[model samples]
Target: MTAVTDQDHTDHTNHTEHADHAGGQGHADAAGDDTGRAEERSENAASEEGTPQDGRSTAAGPDGEDVAEGPEPAAEAALEKSEGEEPEHRAAGGSKKSAAASAGKHAATGPEAPAKDRHARVQADSEGSWDDGLIARRVTEETAAQHVPTAPARPSPPQATAPLAYDGPLRSRLDALRELVGLSRTRLDSRTLAEAGRVLDEAASRRRLSGQHTVVAIAGATGSGKSQLFNTLAGVTISETGVRRPTTAAPIACSWSDGAAGLIDRLGIPGRLRRRPVQSAEAEAQLRGLVLVDLPDHDSAAVQHREQVDRVLALVDAVIWVVDPEKYADAVLHERYLRPMAGHAEVMFVVLNQIDRLPGEATEQVLDDLRRLLDEDGIALGEYGEPGATVLALSALTGDGVGELRESLGQFLAERGAPARRIAADVDAAGWRLRSVYATGQRTGLSEEDRDEFAARLAEAIGATAAGEAAERAWLRNANRACGTPWLRLWRWYQDRLDAPTGRFPARAQVDEEATARQRVEQAVRTLAERASTGLPAPWGQAVREAAVRGAQGLPEALDELAARAGLPPGRPPRPGWWPAAVFAQASMTILQVVGGLWLLGQIIGFMSPNLGVPVLLMVAGIIGGPLVEWSCRMAARGPARRYGQEAERRLREASAGCGRARVLDPVAAELLRYREVREQYGRLMGVPAAR
Candidate 1:
């Protein structure tokens, strides 16, 4: 391979342009130079088919042409020197030169460059010593540039020009979470909602930081050799390693390449503790985008060290828990971190470090024991081709099995998706934490039957039926007063006067029943609230009950007002058309009685001749006929009275129902609707369909 210097690159470009002009001229003089062209073609064919004297094989060039593969020693040394000086500088120079050469060649030859000219040009460039390594470096740089991880593109805020379908799954989930937080802040437990909000905020922050680097924290108990492992992977002693109880006091970040400053800052790592790994070309290439963090010992004696460990651990994309055989089963590690983070198995690694201290057979035993312990801690082990937490056994001091750990990390970095996976796990955990507050089964609302029953209860509570009966009785009383015998009517009037001072009228009794009406209304509301809240989660059930109570605060008073207006009308009940005729018949009987009495008096006093039998018959007929008229009128009034009673009952019942619906049922329904909307949003946040 040979490298293309700046001067050579420029000259090559000029030569290609000159060649294009010469080739066009040659085509114009094709017949005149036929023999010479044939000789040139013969030479080109031999160069293509025959092997070179140096015995170098051919490789495909950037434009699909074959060129010599081996590089001159001098050119290869120069390329290595430049790469050592600065890989970025070498990459930049190589890319510019490669692009220029490719563009010149395409312009000179069009789509189908003549084989003879191509061979000739290749031979000339080969003499000038262009190498395969330079081409390879250019290709690598271009590929890396194309595949660099970028922060996820956030969807623009909702606009008329853009539909929601344009947003990604993450955006949709985040929006759902926002809606849930807004709707359920008052309804749900404060702690649960606060946790969900924290998750959302963290997710947003993570997405906004560096996506190119995967920050993996190396955490372990005191004296676990985690710092040793971090140094081994970095190929430098970036973290302090010693026999002391707490070797690392603060978190140290070692990034393999550039473009992770935002993430490091977010992790709160100071500039003094930031580091770059020193590794060979192949190792550096594999781990180009890794940000390895060395955290303070989790089991440190100092509280601040442990707190720092936890704070850094929360922000990192993944974790490598280094454990020695002695403290592998420490209860603090298992109970405090492992069990609680079981859902994060995919982004975790449990490394059995310092394994060289154990004998070969003992090492295998220790590994198996550690696996059992992790299982007990609820951490899923990725074994036998399953995807879960990775388990590794390595000795950082002895360098035993360190290569395997490095290889695994390289594979992890290649995917460049750790940040996304970590955020998704957090979201899943948040949803799980809030699962109890939401019901997975279908939610029921107040049915029409329930509303109808409530209306009936309200009507009963106001004594609407009793009021209707009272109206019928009043109608009958008035009819009696109109058609009764004069003496009996007079006696009834005197009796009503005697009863008036006792406050025992039907209207007065209704006023005393107001307390009972209020009690019934309260009972009706309580029953309806219970029925509405049944089968719902605790928070939602409480919300429903509260809404019912609020709506029913004035329900009793409103129902009473309705009853008063719809019940028996004021003054005497409406008189039937025949009441007047009945009254005249009764008056005629009264007149006949008076005339007979007068004739009897005259006969006794000898003012006129007396007919004692006729006078007695007249008086008896008057009394008997008066009673018959009154009885007939009462019988005739029965149909009208019954109709009046039913009409009053119907009016009061309907008014009571209307009042109940407006005050109680509507408000409860509105509360239920809000709950359903929030529930659906929660379901979307969890990536599931809500039960309707």
Candidate 2:
């Protein structure tokens, strides 16, 4: 571009624009050379802009009139700027021509002094003239002009807290999802996978565990004293408590440590109330990592409040489900939350709140009834149960069971890994839900018998049997053409040609390549799919059926192509070492017969001495031997031809079956294998040997 500017417009003002816009074209024109273009842009833009706008007189033409723009401020400034950039434009070893053009541009942009003085100044500054001075000065001034005063460096943006790293339980859950997402949604229970995915995302986003915080929520139905319980546990009024039906309208959190700010922020619990527990007791110190949240009533009339409870419930590490004696065994709580969260029983605590309101015997009864409901819900209870969940009777109002509850929370918090355990349980539950998809009580892979049967069906479909019979006939026909008795061989060869006017034999046998064949292949595929899908769930069965017929498109054409390419089992019977002997024996027999007949005729006609006995005996022997030789040759051809036919049949069947395997059976097997793999991955995610 710069070179084009140098050649087209002698003015140096467009140097930057030309170099940027047409650099490639210029380089191509310059034969991959750039130094010449750069030098021209620098020299021409600087030397030629001697305009009146730049405050310099234009150069005189032969008539002494102004020829071009003179050194106005802008012109002089541009010329000087270009001159400063001249050295940068030059290559390490610039050509003499470039240097000359630069020197000429320098001389043209002379100072505006009187003629004699101007000449003297040009001579004085020839080594570093006004051309160089002006270029350097302009370059410096423009560079300075581009500099803007940097404002007090703007304050940095608020740092965004990245979500928790995916590892351990989160990683396992994601890995299990690999198979679940790929599985047939009809069988794999997509709802469970979706829920598990949401849980995984929650774990990643909250990142409380990494923040050294364990978020334990206190959730219960209305009038369950949940907010009061939360306050008693924290030893401060963190949650609003009143006689109001819905005391807590949102999820209020209380962090026992300073590091839980990020955790609280992520939970979206900004305004209700937050407090730090005083370490007056050793238990409080032990509970330092705990961040307790008092959730809105699960059965609240407001949908938003209920939604808040649910949202907080999923994200929390553990739960203390507060229940009064009146609603201790409420089916709503069990069916909605406890039953679904059975896998997370280890982190759950079902507290019989307001125990102070009940008599000793009544309190025991309510606790037992709660236990029964929990058991029925499949929640493993900690006391006298599976040790996965705990049952406690407490009065947040009276602080009766609060101490024991606090101690439990302290111990759970000290473990410093409740979040991981909770996340793992979530994954386990999802895996359990999907168990039917994988654990169908049967092997998932295709058996050899199944494969062989399918292949056989395909072979039948493509008419391998007919092709084999054709191959046998072809081999036999050729055999007779070459090996029969000499006269018969010629006659048979001619007879074989009678059917071939153009001397081109028909195809041994053509595959039907019709819908019947396709239907047969489909049937074989369906059968194989049915067998493979035994004991599999309905969705997987359907999937297997679909997979079995995955590549049905253009199947007939594929079969035809394969058949055409698959030649008959090679059998050139004449190539055998003994075949020549058979032909020779037959030929010899014919010769003997001819010779004996001729000799016999001579004796009968009395052309020679009487030797009728020799001639007649020779003739008889020759006749018998010729028949024997021909019969032997015929007998020899039968075994090889039969064997060859059978071999050809086997080869054709194999080729046809192979095509079936590639186009149909293979895809079906892949689907089954995918199911198996997902099942295995789910098992691993659940931390089990296999899906139950």
Candidate 3:
């Protein structure tokens, strides 16, 4: 009879008294007809069957939240019906040993479960060759399953959408990680990337160039049954199996077929722990190029054990986290490993081992809860972890879901994705950690407006106004010396000498006067540096600040030298081209005055009759011409002097501004450039798409 139908397995529960006097045949008939119910009397025979192989108490756990649902538990009741045509109508006969041996024999060659995931079974002979079924005792207890009424397929676990293959997520995540790592090589903390890169290179090189096997790590907390699962998959006793805490101190490598020496050698496993599996055609053929390692407990009390786990974790192609139903919700497992490596969900597998210990209903319930926690940890499942992370439920000691795991490893190896995907996850993790320093949005440099303000302040510090005024006055004085009336020119020159020394610089006092403005120049540089440093990482900003202030000690002396050199053009502008004309006009006027004066003297001596008229006319002409020449020269010199002075002032300011730019603004600009460079590096490190 089909007692282990998917429908019957759905509502597994612990109860009493399923073994009745109705005999095994009658029980099978009733199971086919009535779905099981969890009355108080279902587990009568199960109680006497012996200890459950799950190695834990078979009691219901506290009701809790939704969990990460793993693969359905393999059903055990597919073939428990009586063999002969006649109904052997009798209660379980003889000692409990015979009943257990009989149950193992039936399951070893049992019919298939309703689901297609069921593996072909190896039959047991009369002498008790029953190693193929779950723990012998558990199978013995399940023999009376037909007598117990079960709920019809409790609830088909929410049918998962078709499995999402790892193509998109795996490739995309890897590319993203590579780009981020390349950018971060120069900036951010290299220690993390260096460690990650070393592992990446080692893994990718070994897997690709060597064309070797996939290195899969079986990891878990102590007592999670990883060793047993590892040995079961290998079909041999390669790893130690025991109840002792922290049983495996070193990782053990098990290779399916012989060409994996290179891959295992790179993993650095000791020769003693590494063993080649005995090849079996029906078993693990697909895992020919696979290297499966059973690692020490991740939460081991020995620091070395934890360290070994971490080292191997960083190097492996993929990691299978084997957790028991009891400690599936462990914080150390989820936080330290799962949550941080969520970017690598593509290459991670979560196994809920020892599902046989939980009754069918509790199995599904706990699986769902585990899934919920994985969701919180950012691990997705399904074909590609799209809907949820891939979770498997199996019992290593019972040999119950081990075959499916072996097959999955075969499929994973054939895809040739674990190494790239694992590295991609690493890069993703490193990028996330540096987000604080690398997330600066855009790259920019100091603005022209800011530079101009700084330049103006530096010009002030160099005393441009003092130099420019002196230039203008000097130009005016030279013009006056050339064009002024001869007698007054000497007097004016002498008078001007005491009144502020036109055209000559160096009051020496002007240098002292610039002290306050020098401080202003320094302040301007600081302000510009501060503005440029905004939004940068602390190191970059500090570097910019230091660069801006580097030449502070020599700045004052440099400014003073620049100020002294910012003098008027030598000897002022040459005398106006028209000055000679003014001199000739004045000379002619003097000659006329002399001639008129002589004529007047002749008239007074009575040397010529009526000469007084000519003398008087000449005298008047000379008098008018002299003053007119003087006025004309004065008017002409006014514009030329003013223009020359303005030209000199302009030149002085240009020279002063240049000095300021070189000593002050230039340093500020250098700092800004440094800031822009670092900012660009930050963008690259963060993997921001727009950093150019």
Candidate 4:
């Protein structure tokens, strides 16, 4: 049997003993053959209850050892009844012992014993030993046991902080820039939104990585040893240094690797990457994150390369101006580039490179002269004692004073002010240019009253009213003669139309003089209109002249319109291009009427026979009537003709007013609109209120 503790097997054995005692007693009473019954019962009990510590419920052989824990222990009387009949039982016990065993078994066989059988024998035994009423108490005690503690609740992750808004004066200027850009139809001609975006992006990027590195550009004239100095400072051949002028055709960038990609990208150079120092370890450490760009000569023979240098130099954070002993004072370099860059003071370094070529004492004198020239160019270096523009003596080819140059670059980069400042500077510069175009303000269309007044003034200046009066008088003079008495009528009509009237015949003097006077007046009015328009602004001045032409031609055009409306007969028209001939014809028609009337007057005065006089008068009247009718028709149209002239002049003035305003104001308004868009975008990015 496997090992079992005494507590484990005790309960099953007790139950088996009680069973044997009860069975022995019951049989002994019924049959009255105690000894034999007891012996047989002992044998059965031994068979039923085998080894106690084995997995058996009773004292049986192999089949009986099935229980995991021993059954409950036997009461005293049950133990005695099985003692003698078998080795385990006592056979000497009388009926009283058997009866006592039966009674003890009866008590042990109560419900508590079966309940105990459900548990391990040791547990059952211990429980059986307790009062039967104590079982509930034991379960209650076990249920009351304490639980272990748990961990504290963890905290949630935090949200990211937003970018701080820019609340400075610069914001207002940016707003204006956006307005200006909005004025453009497609892409802005000058300051585009792309430029604004670039500015913000550059600023934000620099701000984020501020205090990390400084970018310095080595800018100079074509023949200066800028590349040599760049190479010397880097302590290796980072840039191509040569004897030939304009050797560095592209910008060469050298940086200590704290991510120079952004700078390189901004410079917009293709096939150019960051290079490490090839020579001096100290220079590398001192200039860590300090990028030095060796620009192509600004004054290069090739125009494109010069432009490339100028473009990149504008965006660099700092500049190192390399001056040589020979061509340090070139006027073009000083005037074109250096003077213009006077606003950028924090990052300017002037290096008198190749100082070894000059004598020691002469070096100081030359350096002083260079300083004076720089000052004249508006590049303010420090005074005699103060830290002004950094001027250093260095030989890029010989590696002299390169360490100091590297240290200067290190100091500037170490300032760690973010790129936003540089971007702000650029934006400010751009804004100044844009502001110049739109310095005035928004403009709407011209007022109707103003246009009306202008038109009226133009009409008065051209004497439209006077022209109408002159045409009326001319037509009246011609009409009176045409309607006069056949002999006198024809004669009187022509004479009345002319300046000098005659009694017997209409004078050619009246017609000739009056017609010439009308011509002179018309010519004078036309000249007045042209003169009035002379001092007006462009397009407007042209507009007024055109209007005058429109007005001057209005009478003829109106006549055509009236004739078409009135259904008048089409006649052989006088050609406008043949002004000299038309004038002659008009004068001749007046002369013809006078001559015909005088012939009639001769007959009326009785200088010929009655028959001749009558026929001659009728023919004379007919001949003069056509010229008189045409002149009358032109005079009747003069009122409308004058109004048409006035109307044409008015229209020109009105149109010019609007056109002038549009040219001046519309573009400015568009720029303002674009600038507003940019301001809104910037506000969203920076989480700030847009400037008004």
Candidate 5:
């Protein structure tokens, strides 16, 4: 009989426990109605008696007598029932097992066979189906999962995005630099754009280290011995120095090890890149990034060399001016170079080089005097609370105070690095000037009014009055040539009347006076060309008149003097030598014609009657005599005609040469000078250092 039934067990009861297992057969019977089907089937199989129940068996029915076992058959039928209900029953068992696992221990042991089956069934059941309570069970199961061994987490790969490429800014900057490079051709009048290009390149190169390097140039007048100081500071024979006034014709480079290549290259010095390691420990440490330039003398005869000095000076972070004892007070140096450089107050150093030549005790006095002169020149040499312009007495040959000079330079470099900002300012100023000339709303060229002024000046210099006189004289000569001799004198009378309207011909006294003909010419020139004031104080007005007289006096006197110098007579020849020859030939021809006619008449009479030949001879003498007398009168008139022509030609040549020199060439040259002055002034206003 079955002890318990499947329906009798609660769903929450532990399926793996002994009671569940012991009553397993009873519960199996309740689980299904097919309990004896296995035993009946087992008895029908061909089998032997006393077979183990662990083995499955079947017996034959009526055809053969294979008997079935009764007691084992009952047990097998119950097992079959439990086996049929195993899936639901195992689900029940799994819940109990999970509860036991979470409670920190196993709940119970069980009947060996059925309990093992139940446990196995439970694990398989839990994986197949989700119960409503499994989520809460999952939380407890999650804790158990943590105890279960887990694989370690793997690292992620690096991110993959597109590469960064240069945009327009860099290319645009490069384009601007290219433009500047192209502008090198414009270097003679304005290298500002090219300078700006160099500055841009330098800035870009040193963008990260802008405040670290200093470039200083030593610039001064010719004979100032700037090169000597340069060599002394550099501690090398970097700059050529000697008796020649301007030894450093080009910029010289002296720099420390760091970035010296760029500095030298920017200054456009090639083949001098051998780096000079700093010798002094202090200088080596403090002035690691300094570029010192030994610039050409500012007052050099070579304009381009001077220009190079000015250009490099403007771009440098600091300046050291070398001055000589003799010309330290020169107006040209102070006015043209130094005074205009007054804006660069902080970065300037003034050195009195070769001070050893002066008296030992007089150096200080001279320094004081020099400082005072600088002050007068609108330079504040020493101001309180300011880093005044440094004054050093140095003998470059003797190396006197050279150490001090180096120390000062090093200090300056340490404090104020290269003039990157100053170069930018200069570029900006130049751009402003160019913009003025090349403005957006306006076009630039020589204006009509200016052209008229220039033309007027040119006309005046040429002596419009003298040209007009020459033209009138030409008309007179042509008229006289065309007109009969009687009409020619009438033309002369007309000229005299016209002359009366003008003042009388200048006298010898007036021409030789203090304000002479030359003075009048110059005054006319000055008025037309220079715009000298007609209204002036007494002496200056008189002085202008005197200058005019001097200029005017030169032309006529020049002709006369040239003639005198050549040992020719003071005046033109009275007549051309050809005039007398022509007259003599005409006289000879007329006499020959008259004599020929007389001889023919005498021959004819002699043929007619020999006595009549005497009368014919008298007739021939009368004819010849009349012709000879007439020839004498014509010969006498030749002198006056030749004199007139010679004088006219001389006057024409003199007047024409004077007008061309004074008016055309002089005015054109003056205009060129004016253009140059204006250009220089514009450069000055714009703060362009100097064109290279």
Candidate 6:
């Protein structure tokens, strides 16, 4: 009996310990499930709120401190109830295994289990001191919340459209340049404008052709190993090398890929002269868009060979100038090609071929020297990340530095911007060359003061002031003729008839002859032209002069006609209101004198009684009164005559000025306006503001 009781007690104790362990394990599993569900719920809520799940919330309290949130009220309530029932759940040893099994099943099945079993397991798990049931409920609620409808996304705002006139920077510039050339055709010199036109044409043709291909011309002087380098770059012996003075007579093209036929054709390369590289993946991939051309020697003795080289160089996208140490600084190459084309440094390459012949360290020295010479030639050196002409040394015969050249070419090809860059550089070069024709030291135009001076000079040439003086004298003479004593007027007429042969009285003011007038007109026009042409470019100044000369051609004849029409009328000068009274008084005085003289004569002849006092007094009075009235009339006519003369002078001056303005000033102004328009267009083309 004692052994049995002891064994039973030991077994019961073991059973209790096993139950406790199982319950503890169940609690741990439940807690883990609750923590996972809580984390899941938190993630869902954070995502819904568009907040980061990095252990912090974007939400802040009113006081600007971060706010920490707890679980939901329903979850807290369920957790409290589970804690309240924990002791009873621990006391119920019989149900402990079932509860642990159920908890395990719920944790494994998650929310995918049947709703009834999940809820029953949650309640049983809640009977322990764990919040697993609350967390599971929260997850379910959050999952359901995901289906709630959200507001539709906001629509994006509309974007502004670009203007049609602004077709990218390069295209717009090209178009503007074309317009500028057209406008400048009449105002500028043909040589510079012609060059600008050629640039426009080339840019248009290049853009229309294959943009994928880059046409690079290998140009050098005679016996400069141009063909050898060309063949090496092409990886095939396409161009024939020879020891002759001029090895390549014609341009030979080698393309690295297909579809370069259009580009090659535009370059004027014949089908027979076109070649392709040997099929290699690496070469094709690196240089697929390259169109290499071996041009004839630029300094060839043969005229046709040099001509061919020049033509091809003008049409190519880029140039590789192959020079040996002997002729790297050749005067002809530097002056003719490099110096003139300094603006094209971005698309230019100066290669020092035949460096193998140089001794140790001479390569670097030659390269440095070549670079210095290029600088003197005005070509920018593209070294160490600067934008300029690329200078490199390589030898085709010894295959030295050829790979580096190839690699550089490959990198250049990869950019696929060679054609555009080349055209842009050409435009820049052409603009620089034509700068002298367009640019000026100061703004030029016709000024009001200049116009007035020109008109004044023209008026003076027509003798307008002299005409007015003559009109004044004519008025005075006519006033005397109208108001003088009749007897004196008769004597003057008789004397005028007698003196007419001597030409004493002038009819009108003398004017210059047609030839003299024309000279004066031209001089005036030239003066105005020179004034307007100040600080203008040569071409524009010449144009202004031509316009002034052209307008002045008909000016002299027009001014003469105007002078004739502007003169006073051929009849008598206008009679004043007091002229009639003066004439009547003079006539009465003459009659008195005649009567007095008759009385005196009769008395003396004894036809009547002698009245000596009355007759003598009457004769003296008549004589004095007639002279006095004539004097008074002459004095009054002076003021009116002067005014009349001034009016005539003003009319002539005004007429002459009008004629000059119409013929000369208007045309010159029109020419100036044209120049301004073209200048504005040039400014746009060059990407600068127009000068005033």
> Could you say which candidate leads in TM-score?
1
Q: Alpha carbon lDDT of residue 67, candidate 4?
A: 24
Candidate 4 lDDT over residue span 1-692, tens digit each: 01011122232234333544453354334323333334343444535555232212443211123222222233333335433332111111112333344323323333223322322232222222111011111111111121111111111232232332344655564554454455432433433356655565555555444245567789987667887777566543445656777688788676654345556666765332344343124544566667678898888898988888878876777788888888888887788877776655445788988887887697888889988888887666855655447788787656677768767667666655324345555675555443323232333223455444433443333333343343334434333333223455556656568855322211223555445534543453355344543433233334444544444443322322322332211332112233344345445555556666666677789885545555555556656664555455455545543454344334433433333233322333343344445445444333355444
Instruction: Encode model 3's per-residue lDDT on 376-427: one tens digit a residue.
Output: 9878776553633468888887867777887777778887767666655665
Clash number by candidate, in order: 6, 22, 30, 55, 26, 0
What global local distance difference test value does model 4 have?
A: 0.48
**What CA RMSD would you report for each candidate?**
15.2, 26.4, 17.7, 31.2, 33.6, 24.7
lDDT of every model, 2 decimals: 0.69, 0.61, 0.57, 0.48, 0.47, 0.69
True lDDT of residue 431, candidate 4: 50
Residue range 342-438, candidate 5, lDDT tens digits: 6555667888888889886788877888888777766656456564567777888787777788787776666553354344344444445344322
**TM-score per candidate, chains pooled:** 0.68, 0.68, 0.64, 0.40, 0.34, 0.64
lDDT at 445, model 1: 86
Candidate 6 C-alpha lDDT tens digits along 165-208: 21387787788788888888766668767878898888877777
Which stretches of candidate 2 lie above 4 Å from their native place?
Answer: 1-192, 206-211, 275-286, 384-386, 490-516, 538-543, 569-574, 596-615
Error of 3 at 594 (Å): 8.5
TM for candidate 6 is 0.64
| Candidate order (lDDT) | 1, 6, 2, 3, 4, 5
Candidate 1 lDDT, 600-681, residue by residue in tens: 9999999979789887888887988999999999999888888887788889899998998888888888878887898898
Give me the displacement of residue 136 in model 4, in angstroms: 86
> lDDT tens string, model 2, 522-601?
77777887898787777777787777667665665677667666646344433445678877877777777788889878
The segments of candidate 3 whose C-alpha lies over 4 angstroms from its true place after superposition are: 1-211, 257-259, 282-284, 382-389, 496-500, 506-511, 551-553, 563-567, 574-688
| Candidate 1: regions farther than 4 A off | 1-167, 440-453, 482-488, 501-514, 552-559, 576-636, 654-664
Error of 6 at 441 (Å): 3.5
